[model samples]
Structure formats: C-alpha cells, structure tokens
Target chain A: MWAITRLLAGKDLRVEMRSRVIINQVVPFAALMMVMFAFALDSDTVLARVAPGLVWLAAMFSLLVIVQRSFALEAADGALDALRVAGANAGGIFLGKALALAAQLAVLEVILLGAALVLYNSHIVGSGIALLVGTYFTATAGLAFVGTLYGGLAVGAKGRETLLPLLMLPVVAPVLIGATRATEAALGTNGATATDGWPWVGLLTLFAVVFGVGGTLSFGSLIDE
Target chain B: MNPLINMDTRATSTRFTSALGLATLIGLGWLAVFGLFLSPNDRVQKTGVRILYIHVPSAWLAYLAFVVTGLASAGYLWKRTRSLTLDRIAGASAEVGVLFMGITLVSGSLWGKISWGTYWTWDSRLTTTAFLFVTYIGYLAVRDLGGSHEQRARRSGVLALLALVEVPLVHFSVRWWRPLHQQESVAKGKLSDLMLFTLFVGLVSFTLLYVWLVMHRQRVAALDDMVDDGGLDRALADRRSEGMP
Candidate 1:
C-alpha cells in the first residue's frame, strides 16, 4: 500500500514539476483573488480585517481547479483504467491522489499567505504562525479528500466542470468557517482565542478522516465501469 | 387494452390523487386561516410571527424528506432488495426536499427581515438550511447526468448517503460557530395552546402534502422509466435489423 501510494504520488509530482501549472496558473489566480478583494473592499483596514477569509476563499477556488485537473488528467487517455489494471489498490490510489493534491495546495496556500500579508497589509508574527500552518494542513486534507472523491464521481458526467463546485462548496462550509476563524484567531483579530481554533481543527480532522476513509473504501465502486 | 395501460386503474388513481390534493388544499387553507387570524400574535413578535407557521414546517419537511431519501438510498445500495423503486423514491424525496428547502430559506429570509432587521444573517439555522438546500440541489443535478440506470442509481445512492452525513455535521458546526438562531422550543412550553395547535396543523398538513407529492412524483418516474425502456428497446431492434450485431 505504501509503495503504491508513493509511486502514484511520485507520478503526479513529476507531472506537476514538469508542467509547473500550479506555479504559472493557479498561484497567480490565487494572488489575483487577493488583489481583487483589496480592490473590491477599497479600505485598507477592512481588507486587513478580512484577509484571513479572503485567503481561505482563494484556497478553495484554487482547490476546485486542482481537483478538476487531477481527475481530468486520468480521464484524458484512459489512465484511470490503466491504473486499475495495474493492480493498484483503490485505497492507495485515493490516498496517493489526495496526498498529491494536498501537496500542491500546500504550496499554493503558503504563497497565498504571503500574498495576503503583503497585499492586504497584514502581518502574522509569533507562535500564531504555527496555528495558521496547522489550520492550513487540516483544511487542505479535508478539501483534497472530499474534492478528489467528488471529482472522481463527477468525472465523465455531463457538465462536470460546473457540477463539481456546486457539489463541493456547500459540503466544505465547515472547513471554510473553521479555516477562516482559525486564521483570524492566529492573526489576533476578532478577539478570537487560540483555543477557539481547536474545535475547528477537530472538525476539519473529522472531515478528513470521514471523507478520506470513505472515499478510499468507495473508490472501487466509483471507478467501476 | 394492455394491462399496464388499464384505463380503470389510471382513472381511479388520478381521481384519488385529485381528491387527496383537494383535501390538502383545504388543510392548508384552514392552516392559513388559523395561523393568520385565529392564533394570537406574540407580544414581542406580533404579526411577524406568522412566518413561523410556514417556515418551521417547511424546514421540518425538508429534514424529513432528506431522511427518507437517505433510507431509500440505503435500500437501493443494498443488494438484497435493490430495486428501481428505491432509486425512484430517493430521487423523488430529494426533489421534494429541495423544494421545501427553498421555501424554508425564502420564508426564513422574510422572517429574519421582519424580526432580525436584515434580509439574511449567518445565524446557525439559516446557514445550515442554506447548505442543505444547495446540497440536495446538487443531488438532483447529478441525477440528470444520464448514465445507465444501474450506474445512476449506484452513484446517486452513494451521494445521497454522503450528503445525509453532512446534515448532522452542518447542524453541529453551525451551532458551535454561532448560537444566534432561537433555540428549538416550539414543541416545548414556549407557545400558547392556540399557537401550538395552529403549528401542529401546519406540520401535519405539510407532511401529508409531502407524502402526496412524493407518491405522485414516484408514479411519474415509473412512467418515465417505461418510456425510456421502450425507446431503448426500439433502438436495439433497429440496430439488429441493420445487422449491427
């Protein structure tokens, strides 16, 4: 299982490294989201106050793109069939794809954090940065697990590009709420507590476990022709 | 006449449905009369509280519909008794669920405007209901993706179950996030007897209305399946005559 997961993750990482689509396309899109938010709000104080949420919104939008690409990559040349015929375990395949997506999102989110700090004239200093990282990991895990599952389900379905986000965004509301509130607490805004972030962390973790395991066990059924 | 197309059964069922629809109409009419005229207004809420009769029952029916959808989906997924009927029931219930969810949101918005002084709020119940609305709308959309009956049934049954899991999670998450909505006490000691009676009338009538809608929709689905199967059979026969294996 470990070997298959690594092999699949390595395959995706190699494709991402060569293409740099995440760098050239998605990162800039996330950055543009910050710039647009700043322009729309048109107040430095308000922008600063809302930067945490803006960062999360950017991550989620980028997530839609990444998950779409993940499934699309397989569906293109029947690579999904190729993987199945290669005797890859469904659970390993799910975990590998989720890990690969999470890795890409982690990089995108780190860049967005910098963009949020610089573009919104906000700063994160202290042990609070650790909380921010924690929130990012858990939130991304939940999103990747869920997004990958739904992406696979939506693949080959009609109008999947439009369908995936409609299916995904509402389901991930708790993550958005948790991640935003956690980020706000980390930034010492909204009179929020570091303790306030824990339940959100727990929720994100639960989402990750439920969807992650559920997606793994169900992937075989989803991929059945 | 074909047994499946028996005029007597069809006519009787249609008549029964109309009779049930009329009763529902009368039940709802009396509910409005009771809610609007007979039930006394709250000292604090006054007439604005009238929205509660519609809003609460709609939310209740939405939850009830989704729960039925979940159970029907479970039946569809289980191999022992797997049937198209289960799938059809699930889809029908989800459709009714989405309709009621929409009503819940719209009425809640109006209620909030009258009482909370805003058209919307991030209040926990409101937020969760909105999520429920969108999720089932997605469910209904996925049903239209047009696969083989088995594939569509399997995929949608899985999605229905997954979405069901979110109902409780959304409820808890929102409750923890913001305790803004009023606590659930309508069935408790909160309301006066007349108000409680009116509310019960609303609940019972709306539930019957949901059953009527689901049954009618399920029959429509069955007819649709018959038509779809006939089309496929004709297509296959045409292909066979053309020597296309």
Candidate 2:
C-alpha cells in the first residue's frame, strides 16, 4: 500500500513537474469559464449570488478534465499495465491516485478562486470562499474517487471522447446538487444552505465511500487489461 | 473448444418466434393508436397531462431497468459462471434505461411547457430523473471498456453495484431537493384504481419490450460468438471435419 502510494504520488508529481499539464489546462479552462459567465451575466448583483456555485462548478469541471489527463498520462506510458504485472494492489493504486487527483484539484481550485476574486470583483477568501472550498473538496473527493473507477473502464475504447461525458455527468449529479446548493446557502439564501445541503454532503460522502471501496475492490479485475 | 457446446445438440431458432415479436408490435400499436391518441385529454392537466403517459412509463422503465441490471450484474459476479443470459440482461437493461430516460427527459420537458408555463424547471422529480439518465449513462460507459470478456465482465459487475446508488438518489432527490416537481402522491403510494390499472398495464408492456429485446439481442450475440469460435477452431485444425468435410 505504501509502495503504491509512493508510486502514485511520484508519478503524478513527476508529470506535474515536467508537463505542468494540469496548471496549463485547469487554470485556463476555469478562467475562461469565469469570464464567459461574467460576460453572460454582466451583473454584479447576479454575479455575487451565483459566484459560489459558478466557482465550484467551474472548478469541478476543470478538475474532471484534470483527472482524465492524469489517468491518460499513466495509460500512455503503460504504467498501469506495468503496475498490474508487478502484482501491485489495486486498492492501494486507486487510493494513491485518488489522493493525488484530489490534491491537484485543490491546487487548481485555489487558482480558480484567485482568478475569480480579481475578475468577478468578489472577496477572494471570504466565508463564501470557505463554502466554495469545502464544497470543492468534498465534491471533488467524490469525483476523483469515481473518476478512477471509470478511468479503468474507459481506458480503452473507440470514440472515448464521446463516452466520458455520457458516463460522467449523470453519476455526479448529486455532487452538483450538494455543492451548488451549499454554495447558494453560504451566500445567504434563507433556505438554501448546507444545513439542507448537509444531507447532500452526506450523500456525496456516502457515494464516494461506496464507489471508492467498490472500485478498489474490483480494481484487481482490471489488472490484466 | 471449451467443451460447453460439444453436446451434439444443435441450437434451434424456436425461441426466435415471429409471433412474439408481432404480438409486441400489436400491443405497442394499440397503445399508440388507442391509449395515447384516443385517451381523454385529462381533466386537470389537459393536453399537457397526456405526455404523462409517456413520461411516467419512461420513468418506470428506467427504474425497472436499473433493478434488473443490478440483479443480473450481481448474479454474474457471484457465480462467475459466464452465463450469456445474464450478460444479455445487463446489456438490455442499460440500453432500455437510457432510451426510457431520453423519453422521460423529452416528454417531461414538453409536459413542463404546458404545466409549468416553461420548458424547464429544477423540480425534484426532473432533477432525479436527469440524474437517472447519468447513472445508466455510466453503465453504458462501463459496457464499452475494451478487454477480454471475463475482464470486462468483472469490471462492469463492480460498476453495476456502484451505479445502483443513483436509484435511491434519483427516487428521493425530489423530496431531498425541494424543486418544482410535486412530491410523490400516487407513484410512491397514493394510486387511484384508474391510475394504478393503467400503470400496471404500462409496466407490463414495458417489461415485455425489455424481455423481447434482450432475448433477441442475446441470440444475435450468441450466434456471432459461435461463428467466430467455429471459424477460429476450423482454421487451427490439422484436418478439417465438420463444415469443411
């Protein structure tokens, strides 16, 4: 387990250092999303009300794209094939990867928050930002946790470009609900807070644990592939 | 060559009856022609409610498909028996789930226009059903993972179990997330005899569609597998016997 963790962290760190792919992609994607959103709305009042959810949503999307790239790097290098052949534990591998993915997403979210602060004219690290951070971490944990599972499933396929969204969007709806609502609540809607979203948080957390555990359990089966 | 099909019993096409397929066609035709176009325009919801027949049944099929997929997926993993029947069940269920979900989305939106004075709303039922679309979409995604048969099956089995989370989440997210969609009154419990009877029949018809499609697709797959296996073995033989001889 420790070995897998080291490999996971090492592999992602190496990639991040060499290509800086996630930063190049996530930062730009998130920034563009914010700009487009601001362009569409162009209202300061509306921006304040919608900013938290927008930040979280854009961050979530940026992170999803990041997760795929993370896995795709391993896939292209045949690292996954080598890992399975070496008799590495599937659970450990998934854990290591999920951790790294979460870590990378956190970094991206911070950048996104910074950009939004300057661009959207909102407080950067305020309570709303706190809610955004919490929601991003929780929802992203669920996303990466599930992402690794699907990554293995979609590791090989034609038109995989098409498959990822079809496969991903629906499964992660709960995260969107919880994160968006929690963000909405944090921004001071009378009834839209995580107080209600706490259950959704609970749901997102539950989904993460269940699928993460299940994905790890079944990871061995994909070892040969 | 694994000795499973060497029992000398030739596979037959009896199960592939024209009659059963025709009967389903007739039933669907009756529903579309009579039940849909011929049914009353509804008392409360008016023409808008007519889409309910499509929406409700589509939602029903989506849910049923999830349950069936889960069951068959469980069986495949538990026994590791490699049954074609179970594989077909999973395959059919996912496809039907997606198709019904598509219907549910479209008809729901169309219904929403007349009922809610808009084409879209974030109501709870709509949200869950939309998520329902995602759950099975993931299943369909899992099915496409390329690998050897056993490996694919094992991976998909785990996915099947994981995707079941959407079932409760979809069903409850309505009440869970206070949206425009009404809380369940009849579908969950409060069904009048008229509604229940129509729904029961609708459910039966949907199930029938599922069964027929699954069996047909299974037959096609089994045949394709047989042809490939036979061709490979014949190519390898030191001497050609069966078809060559």
Candidate 3:
C-alpha cells in the first residue's frame, strides 16, 4: 500500500512538474486573491489585522482549483477507469492524490505567507512562528483529504465545476475557522497568546485524522463505476 | 398494465399518512395557541422569548432530520441493507431538514435582534448552524446530480457519512473561534413552568410535522424514480420499434 501510494504520488507530482499548472496558474491566482484583499480592505491596519484570515481564505479557494485539476487529470483520459481495471488499491489512489495536493498547497501557502508579510505588512511574533507552521501542516492535510474526496465524488458529473465547490466548501469551514484562528494567534494580532493556537491546531489535526481515515476507507465505494 | 410501470398518478397518500397529517395539524394549532397566548412572558426577554418555541424545536427537529438522513444513507451503503428506499428516505429527510434548518436560522436571527441588538452575530452556535445548513444543501445538490440510482446512492452515502463526521469538528472549531452566547436557558431550567410546557408542545408538534413531511416526501421520491426508469424504458422500446419498421 505504501509503495503504491509513493508511486501514484510521484506520478502526480511528476505530471504536475511537467505541466507546471500549479506553479503557473494556481499560484498567481492565489497571489492575485491576496492582492485583491489588500485592495478591498484598503487600510493597512485592517489588512494587517486580518491577514491571517485572508491567507487561509486564499488557500481555501486555491484548494478548489488544485483538487479539480488533480481529479480532472484522471478523468480527462480515462485514467481513473484504467486504474480501476488495473486493480490499483483505491485507498492508495486517495492518499496519493491527497498527498500531491498537500505538497502543492504547502508551496502555495509559503508564497501566500510571503504575500501577506509583504502586501499586508503582517508580522509574525517569534514564539508564534512554530504555531503558524503547525497550523499550515495540519490544516493543509485536512483540506487536501476533503478536497480530494469531494473532487472524486463530483468529477464525472455534469456541471462538476460548480458542483465541486458547493460540495466541498461547506465541509472545509472547520479548516478555515481553525487555520485562521491559529494563524491569528501566531501573528499575535488579536490579543491571542501563542498557546491559544495549539488547541486550534489540535482541532485541525483531529479533522485531518477523521477525514484521512474516512476518505481512505470510503474512496473505493465513492469512485467505483 | 406492465408490472414494470406504475400508472397511478394520484399523490402518494395513505390512511396512515392522512392520520399523521391530521395529528400534525392539530398539534401545530395547539402549539400556536399555547406558545403565543397561554405562556407567560419572561421578565427579561418578554414577548421575544416566545420565538424560542418555534426556534428551539425547529433546531432540534432539524438535527433530528439530519440524523435520520445519515442513518438512511448508511443503510443504503451497507450491502446487506442496500435499497433505493433508503436512498429516498435519506433524500427526503435532508430536504425537510433544510426547510426546518432555514426556519431555525430565521427565527434565531429574529431572537438575536431582540436580545443581542443585531440581526446576526458571529456567535459559535449561529455559525455552526449556518455551516450545517449549507452542508446539507450541498448534499441535496449531489443527490440532484444526474446519475444511475446506484451511483447516486453510493456517492451520496459516502458524502452524508463524511459530512456527518465533520459536524462536530465544525462545531468545536467555531465554538473555540468565538464563544459568546447565553448558556442554553432550557437546559438550565431557567424558564417558567408554562414556558417549559409550551416548549415541550412545540417540540412534539414539530417532530410530528417532520414525520408527516418525510413520509410524503419519501413516497414522492419513489414515484419520481419510477417515472425516470419508465421513461427510459419507453424510449428504448420506441427505438426498437422504429428499427423493426
């Protein structure tokens, strides 16, 4: 299972590397969203105060694009059906796709943090830096698991472009709430101590575990033809 | 008459369903009188407290409805219990649940206006309820996505299960994000006896109404599936006849 997972994850990453869709399209889109937030908020104080939330919001929207692209790759050329016929383990497929999504999102988030720091002029306190990284890791994992699962669910359907977001966004509300709060605590912008961020990270970790196990167990039944 | 096709065009009603509807109507009327005219005003909230009769019960029933939906979806997914009926039940319950959830939110908003001096607040309970409402709405959308019945069942069953698991996570995250709301008055036995009784009446009536609606909705869903299947069969038959001629 681990071998299959590695192989599929490597395939997705290599495909992504060759295509450069995440680097070329999704990254700019996420950065543009951060810039747009700066424009909409306009005030430096307000922008700095809410930078954590803006960053996660940008990440969440980018998640939709990345998940759609991941599943769309499989759907475009009957790759999913071929995998099924080849008797590939469904759990491995789910984990591999989710792993690839998390990797891409990790990179996107690093860039988003830079954008927040530069554009929003947000400063992360020394103690909170570790909390901020923890939030990114756990929250990204949670979002990837959910995004991949719902992407597969909506992939073959008509109007899937609209359907995927509708199906996915509500479920990921926890990640948005948790990640934003943890990030805020890390930035020390809202009178929250760095210790306050750990509990939210715990929530994110719980979410990741629940969906990660749940997604692996159920992905076969969901995407089965 | 083909056994494969049901020709009945009448509404899916039965004697038991009629009895259930009648009981719901009577219960609703009783609740309205008691909740509005009979129950005493709270010293603090006064007339605004009356909305609790509708708001609290609607919220409870909405949760109940979603629970029913989750169970029905589980039944459909389990091979030993798999059936289109369970899928229909899940779909029906979710539809009714959304309606009740909408009522809960609107009423809660009104209550908030009276109590919190705003039409909306980012309170934990309010946020979680809103998220649950949207989640179920998305679940219903997935059900409407075109697919074979089995495909619909499998996809939505997995979704329902996943969404159900996320509810607690969403609740806790929101609660921690901002915890502000009066502690639940009912659980604390803070209400007067008459108010409590009226609230009880509200709960019973709303539950009955949920049952009546879900029963009718499930039957309608079964009929809808039959019509869809029958239409495809008729189309195939027509094509075959055209080729023969």
Best by DockQ: 3
Q: Relative to the unseen true structure, what is the C-alpha lDDT of residue B27 in candidate 1, on a scale of 0 to 100?
A: 84
- Model 3's CAPRI class is high
Sort every candidate by DockQ, greatest first: 3, 1, 2
Worst 10 residues of 3 chain A by lDDT: A1-10
| Docking level of model 2 | medium
Candidate 1, pairs of clashing residues: none
True contacts kept of each: 0.56, 0.59, 0.87
Better of 1 and 3 by lDDT: 3
In order, the Cα lDDT scores of the candidates are 0.85, 0.69, 0.90
Per-candidate interface DockQ score: 0.67, 0.50, 0.84
In the range A1-225, model 1's lDDT, one tens digit per residue, is 778789888999899999988889888888888888888999988988888899889899999999888888888988887888988887888888889999999999999989988888777747577788788889999988988888888887769999999999988888888888888888877667576677778888887888988898887767766
**Which of the predicted structures, 1 or 2, would earn the higher lDDT when compared with the native?**
1
Predicted model with the maximum TM-score: 3
Off by over 4 Å in 1: A85-87, A191-193, B1-23, B185-188, B235-245
- Computed on C-alpha atoms, the DockQ of candidate 1 is 0.67
1 or 3, greater by DockQ: 3
**Model 3: CA > 4 A from native:** B3-6, B236-245
- TM-score quality measure for candidate 2: 0.82
For candidate 1 chain A, the 10 contiguous residues with the lowest summed lDDT are: A189-198
Model 2 chain A: worst 10 consecutive residues (lDDT sum): A188-197
